[model samples]
Target: MLQQVSFPLRTECPPGACVCERERLLAEPDADLRPLRLTRMEEQKLIDRIEGIASYEELKRLQDRIRTNLGVELKITPSPNEVRTLRGIVILLEDRPGLCKKVRQSIPAAVRKALERHPEITYAILDANDLFGM
Candidate 1:
């Protein structure tokens, strides 16, 4: 009589040679994905900046600036369901595969903070894999 054991396959590709999305995502530091905690003044300034946004181009510019300054990616758009109001905005924290555990865990708090500070933004959603949807 003989006994045999099976082994699970490696899910991750080797470093430097990985071409998969997960590998690329894992390469980025979690710190970059996580938004910095700002002071009350800084938070107010950020909200003020967002509050005065009058056009899509301006919003896009702010998004670029945030990405450049904070290394945190954000997408802003008009709320699909709420149309007749100027303040009906949706803030989406862009999502992708292979985000580190720390970054993934921080997303909900990030969304909450975003919503709490800006009444202009009606919804803050996590795109792609929707943890909040669960």
Candidate 2:
């Protein structure tokens, strides 16, 4: 007979620290789940990419690149007023399933192009959100 399995959220680790408890559980003979972990350098790269951006136009360019290269519908909604700071480019995209994979696949190239197109852009951040009220 098949049994239902549930994983618990670990609260002991610090806010951004990586956890591998799920992996440990999966290693069990009867466990039915898999866990994923990213190396420290990989995590740092993600933080740098998201935090290094500097302008809305750069964000738009990245979004356009993703749409063109990945065939993903990425919409960027910039704030009405422009605030110039080192905060970089921040964008909100509809969080449909599988969209993240497309964004991930396209980002490296898109970022490279954005850098070449706009020297002012230092970083870009793409955040996903649920658009459907469901």
Candidate 3:
């Protein structure tokens, strides 16, 4: 079983000293720790939610939302320089079972618009089914 305990606050650092701290903390060791535990009912609820994600667009929205929830800086715009190089933010939404698209050709113009805006997007496979390929 999990338990909670409390301790008194203690700090030696001076005020106004932790500016730009996110970068420093990120750079520090073992910052990638996010603990998660789920009860049986919660696990079943999560399974149901995953099963209910119906469409590609819904998947994208969910992914973007999760990033927002996690305080991640998202890059919705991808560059258009695939021939030269591949770089930029690429958010993949989901891998629906038995659904796949190899190229961005089949993607709607609405989705392609992000890639067209910036020439700096070196390469974007941007497969709709590939979640957060970055």
Candidate 3 has its poorest 10 consecutive residues by lDDT at 97-106
Best by lDDT: 1
Model 3, global lDDT: 0.34
Give Cα-based local distance difference scores for all models: 0.45, 0.40, 0.34
Q: Using Cα atoms with residue i matched to residue i, what is each candidate's TM-score against the true structure? A: 0.37, 0.27, 0.26
Error of 3 at 68 (Å): 5.9
Tens-digit per-residue lDDT, 50-86, candidate 3? 3455444554574465345323322343444333323
lDDT of 1 at 31: 22
Which regions of candidate 1 fall more than 4 Å away from where they truly are? 1-34, 77-90, 94-134
Q: What is the Cα-based lDDT of residue 14 in candidate 2?
A: 42
Q: What lDDT score goes with residue 37 in model 1?
A: 30
- lDDT head-to-head 1 vs 3, winner: 1
Which candidate do you rate higher for TM-score, 1 or 3? 1
Top model number, TM-score: 1
Alpha carbon RMSD to native, model 3: 15.9
Candidate 2: Cα lDDT at 40: 39
Quote the lDDT for 63 in model 3: 42
Q: Please give, for residues 61-111, the per-residue lDDT of candidate 1 as tens digits.
A: 777876675456776455556434434445555553433333333443454
